[model samples]
Target: MTPDLEKELDDFKLSHYENADFDSLTKKTIQLYNKFERLKDKKKQNRVVLDLYTLYLQATEILFINSHALSVTVDRFPSALFIDSFNLRNFISENFAKTTELSSWFFKLIFSVLKDNSGTNEKYNLYTNLIKEVAKDYLGDYDLLNAYKHGYRVKANHSQTTLSISVGNGQHFKLNDSDSTITYFSKETRDGVPIVLQHTLNFKIGRIFGKCLFVCSLLNNMRAIILLHYKKPVSSKDISSFYINDKDEWNSMFGGSHFKQPVFSLKGLNKKNAIPK
Candidate 1:
C-alpha cells in the first residue's frame, strides 16, 4: 500500500463519518480482522479464516485502486501503470508496453503487435487464423462467467443476477444454487473435481502476495477480450478490408489488376469502404 493512499483513506474515514456503505466497509474490515485475531483453531477454521482475509484485502485494494489510479499520475513511476486496469488499452496500440488482460496468456500479444508493426506475414497470418478461432470461444456472452467454474454452466438469462464462484475446499459443489457453502468440506458434501482444483491452486501459492499475484493473472484472462479490442493496433474499419472477399472485390474496380498487382489500396478500392488516406 502506498503512503499517500493510506493518508487518503484515512481522510475518507474522517470526512465521510456518516456514510453507511463506508461504515459497512469499516465494520467488515474489523469483523474480518477480528476473525483473524483469535484464531486459536489450527485446522479447517484456520484455512477458511485465512482465505477470507486474503479475499477481503485484495477486494479492498481493488476498490482503492479504482478510485485513485488515474489521479496519482507521476512521471518517474512507469511500473505503476502496469497494474492500471484503466489505461491498459493504450499499451496494445502504441509503442508503449504494459502487461494487459488480453495477452495475459503467453503468445496472445504476438498477433496484435505483428499486425500493427508489419503487414501480414507468415507468423501474423498463423496468429490471425488462431485468433479467429479463439475469438468465438471468448465472446463472454453472459453465461460465459456462469459456465466458467462449473463443469455444467448455468444457461444465462436476464433473471440470473450475480456471477458466483465455488469457494472453500469445493465440497458443496452443487449446481442448483441452493445449498450455498457449509464452511469447510467434510468429504461427505462434494468430494470431487472442484475440490481438486481448489486444493491444487492452494499448493501453487501459499502466501498473501502470491495469491494476489495469482488474482492479477486471472484479471488478465477474465477481461482479456475487452482489453484486446481497445488495444488493437488498427481501427475496426481497417479489419473489414482483410476479411472482404479478395477474389470478389478484385474484379469489381481493380479488375484484371490482381494478376498485375495483388495488394489492396484506397485508390484501387472499387467501393468507398476500403479506401484509406
Candidate 2:
C-alpha cells in the first residue's frame, strides 16, 4: 500500500473508534441503574413490571450492540457495523469457543497482548469468563427478544402463575411459576402430540443494569487491546481507565447477582378437547 493511502486508512480506523461513543453508553447505564433501584421500591406492581421489562430489554440490546462494536474493533471488519443479532450471536459463539481457525487466530492475538499488558492469569480468566457469561446471557434471551421485535408477542404474567397443558396421547407437561416478568408461548409438535413452548424471562433489575455496565467496561478494555495490537496509541484518559480504577463503586452499585437464565418448557398440545370452557 502507498504511504498516503495507508495513512488515510489509518485515519479512518481511528475515526471509527473515536466515534463509537462508548462514554455515552456508560452514562446511560448509570442512569438506568438508578432508575432500576428507584422502581424496585414502588407500590404499583403492574407498572413496575412493565418498567422492569422495558429496562431489561434496553439493557440487553445495549449489551448486544457493544459486543458487535467489540467484534468490529477486533477484526476491523466493515460488515460488523450493521447490527444483526444472528451475526452477533455467531461472533459471540465463535469467540467463546475459540476453536475455529479464524477465532483462534484473533483470540490469541488479542489476549496475548492483554496478558502482556496486565501480566496476570487471574485477570485474564476474569475477562474471558465475563465474555462467556455475556454470550450465554444474550443467547439465552434470543427467542424472547425476537418475540418482542417481530410481533410484540410476549405477555406480562402475574407472579406465581403456572402454565399447564395436556399433550395428546396421555402425555402432559407443566411449567411451574418462577415469578418471571414476562411470558411467551408458541406452538409446536412433538412426536405427533402438539405442545406449547413457554418461555419465561425474569431479571433482577440491578443485575440486568449491571450487565450493561459490564458490557461497557469490556468494550473499552477490548478497544484498548485492539488499538495496541494495531500499534495505535491509547489515551491515558480513555474510558477504560475509569472502569479499571472505580471497579468497586460500580460493582457495589450493580450488586453481585448473576444473570438469570430464561426458562423454557414444552407444555402440552392445544386441543379443543383438552380444555373446558
Candidate 3:
C-alpha cells in the first residue's frame, strides 16, 4: 500500500478506537466505582477521587461538544477529533442554561428517556433531580479542575486544624474539613489591603463515583438521541420521531436505579474577609 493509503487506514483505526472508548465511558465509570468500593485505604481512595475527577472533566467536555453540534442549524456531529473551543464553564452557561434552546431540547430528550425507562414519574423525578445535582456540582467545582489541570495547585486536606487567615485588625476567615477535602490558596488585594483567598472543594469518594456514572449515562443517552435524529429531514413539530425506540437498550445503558447524588462543595473565598486593613 502507498504511504497515503497506510496513513488513511491508521486514521480510520484510531477514530474507531476513540469512538468505542467514548461509548465505554459509562462502563469505565462503573468499574472505577467498584474499585473504590473494594478499597479501604485512604491513599487508594484519594487515587480513585483523582481518577473520577479526570473522567468527570472529560465526560463534561464530550457532552458539551456534542450538545453544541446538535444546537447548530446545520448537521454537524462531533467526532473524536473535534475539540470544544469554549471554556467548559462558559459553554455550560451559554448552551445549557435553563432558558437556552439547546438546554430545552437536551433535557427534554433526557427526561423522555428517563421516564420511559423508569416506568414511573417518581423514579423519573428522582433521576432527574440527581442529574441536576451533578450538573450543579460540575459547575461549582470547575475551578478546582482547572487548578488540578493547570499547575497542580490543589492538594488533599489532611490537617486536623481548621485553616484560618487573619485579614488584619480583628476579622478572620476559617476553612474546615467540612468545607472541603481539597484546598488551594492564592493571595489578592482588596482596596490596597492584601489578603489570602482560600480556594476549597470537597466530595465524598463514593458519591462522586456514582455521580460520574450517572453523568456518563446521561451523555450516552443524549448521544443516542442525537444520532436517532441526525440529518433526518424533520421539523420541530415532529418531536415524536426523536424518542429512543429501543427501550430495553436504553434501560440497560442509561439505568439510574443504583445511581447516587454527589455531595460536594466549592467555596472560593470569603468576601467578608476582603475588608481593607
Local accuracy of candidate 2 as per-residue lDDT tens digits, 1-277: 6778666766666666656666666676676556645654543443445444554455545545554555454344444556676776776666653423443343454455443455455555555555566566666655665566644566653344444568778876863323435666544456654455666565344445555666666456556665675777877545352123456643543211122332333344256545321
TM for every model, in the order presented, reads: 0.21, 0.56, 0.56
On residues 21-125, what C-alpha lDDT tens digit does candidate 3 reach at each position? 454777688787788668788777666656666677678666666565555433223242364444555666655543345555666676664434444545445
Off by over 4 Å in 2: 1-8, 40-76, 97-119, 155-180, 185-197, 225-237, 241-277
* Model 1 residue 245 lDDT score: 32
For every model shown, the clashing-pair count is 0, 1, 0
How does candidate 3 score on lDDT?
0.53
Off by over 4 Å in 3: 1-20, 75-88, 94-104, 111-120, 157-180, 185-197, 230-277
* Consecutive 10-residue window with the lowest summed lDDT within model 1: 253-262
Give the local distance difference test score of model 1.
0.30
Q: lDDT by residue for model 1 over 37-142, one digit each (tens)?
A: 4556645344444444335344434432322232243332224424553343232222112222333333343234323554445434433433332222122111
Screening candidate 3 with a backbone cut-off below 3 angstroms (N, C-alpha, C), the clashing residue pairs are none
Top TM-score hit: 2
- Give Cα-based local distance difference scores for all models: 0.30, 0.53, 0.53
Give the candidate order by descending TM-score. 2, 3, 1
